[model samples]
Target: MKGWKNPILLVLGIGVSNIGNWIYFVAINLLVLKLTGSAAAIAGLFIIRPLAILFTNTWAGSVIDRVNKRRLMVYIDILRGILIAIIPFFNSIVPIYIIMFLTNIAGAFFGPTSETYITKLVPPEKRKRFNSIFSFATSGAMLVGPSVSGVLIMYGSINTSIYINAVTFFFCALAIFFLPDVDEKLSSEKVRERITMKTIAEDWKAVISFGKTATGFMIIFLMFQFITLISFSLDSQEVTFIQQVIGLSEKNYGLLVSLTGAGYVAGSLAVSALANRLSIRMLLGMGSFLSVTGYLMFYLASPQTIPLAVVGFIIIGFFSPFSFTGYATFFQNNVPVDLMGRFSSSFAFFQAMVQILLTLLLGYIAEVVTLQTVTVAFSAIGLLLAAALMSLIFLQSKKALFILEAENNLTEEG
Candidate 1:
């Protein structure tokens, strides 16, 4: 526990920020609806986040890799806090959207920067446990944040919730300020290189070169990303599917969401407790396969089998942390820490682009075809991808990748 002080602090900081993010999510939707009285306006808020990611990630990596990540994280959090704090002052929808866009742009940069920082801070042997604890914090926020927002809005106002969220970001910045500067030893020239068009181009080339040279890693990465894309597409339709197809009430849906959060929290705790017991391959392969099966169970369930759907949700939520933590550990151990930011951002850029396209396509298809049919088809696709991912994960030739000590030794030898 003594050895975990800094990592634990890092987790707490992230957890606080996540709670604020969710609170802002609910408040912003209501605020947009109040201002414009249009569902489209609220929907536009959703588009702004991924659009911001697309706009920023192309060059964000160049800056992320060259800067002191800890300082960059502090600045980004403060910037987001300021942007969110002023959101309540905007009576017009356009201005609010503009502010939200800028805030998300800051968020886009922060994601990769934080990932790189985490990789540098947490030792390889401890990442699985660290990530499990991180997952627990995130899942707890998922449960608590919205409920807190509801209370704030009910007792106070939407503005109150927004202001509180802004404060959380500032709190996150403060927490980040206390973190050690892991980049202190990095070469001065590397850190001082001004971000230029040429630097950005070279970073992209380096990412491409890594992808070509490390085909297995890229394949696993993309397959896992595709599975996530499926999950996101399914989530976008979850409300409609539960209400219309499964004949569940809004209250039931809310309860189900709460249950999912509980499941995630429980699963994260289990992973943390059993971190040393479970191998990375088992966590990645079995965890993902079972999660997909849960999705399958839910999708195939009827109104008469609502309990089955409930169980399915629990299963998916519980096992998802296993897959996520496993992948984070795998990624941190495998990717060079120096290139972590660029690799994360570059892949995220493509993932965001595909997510936008896939989400739109799923929405359209659900309208054209039956929602049930579309969801089932996508879930089946997810199952196939998970199976393939598991197969790749357990391959003998790739076994070294999942073993941290062996991989580190191999890297040293190379």
Candidate 2:
């Protein structure tokens, strides 16, 4: 199989799988809220899935590298489909929690393993384009997925959305059939050497802590994750702010979220064009700066102004892909390919762990403090962290732009 075709198929397949997640999440959150009328329960459900992912991602990654990534993804998708199909019939909170737990198990394996396959299939030179295309595919699905899920719940039923999620997962599994074996020709000896969790963890530790550059990158990446979680967790508050100030309905929340996704699509397009010209360090730094401004705008919006919030979301979407894609590409470039799955999984685990903590923390703040106050405070904290991380990137590298120069040198040598 040619390179582009494989990545394209992978993106579509993964996007299809993500739609299931999107549907399940929308249905569950809305249903739980309708049933219990409790924010804490809603938050609990959101937090539990990521917490499960945090604990399992490293182990999942280890398994992925040693086993067949394609098969693992296929089985994971199928299992998740069955789990979703089972969820709607059982209305008890206990059963719902159990099904959600199972979904998290599948998510932990599927996401990192698929990312590992992408790292292998997509060359460094083509990552920007590939990520842009992939981001657009997933984000586009996300844009539609929630609205469709909402419609299914509003018109048909919550159970209908669950059924749709199951079908989507099955289709996702079928799409996996098109994926080539990315680790196709590994020798028996090498496979045997990599079988243990300890071996993979050790490998991951070495790469992430390899030097100041690697460590610094990881720190900054962690901050990036923190900021993203804080921002997303504010979704409800954002809608509240709009409602209180401008008298918009809760429905506009979806439109604003779609705007954010649209911003991501726009950013993805630009990153595809400009990433090769910019260093990863430069891209991340600028992305962080834009995010700070965007969040600030959202927080400071006046009572009569809702468009400002929309603009802020648009800016976030536009710049977020640049930072995210740049970071992922940088990790791929710096880390050894053999350890890619482990390193990616470990990195993802830490990010998820932080997000889980922050979700609870931020939820508390939103509850105890005013949402406006919470939004401003966290947005400021996120902005400050972004600036600091950007400054450190330049300081540590001691070069204004390293990746572009490095790539140019490589090109000249070639």
Provide backbone clash counts, one per model: 0, 2
Local accuracy of candidate 1 as per-residue lDDT tens digits, 193-269: 88889999999999999888877778888898899888898889888889998999999999999888999999999
Name the best candidate (by TM-score).
Answer: 1
- Report the C-alpha lDDT of model 2 over 329-350, residue by residue, as the tens digit: 6555655566666766776777
lDDT for residue 121 in candidate 2, whole number 0-100: 78
Q: List the residue pairs that clash in candidate 1.
A: none
Residue 216 lDDT (model 2): 48
**After superposing candidate 1, which stretches have Cα over 4 Å from the reference?**
397-414
Candidate 2: residue pairs that collide: 263-317, 264-317
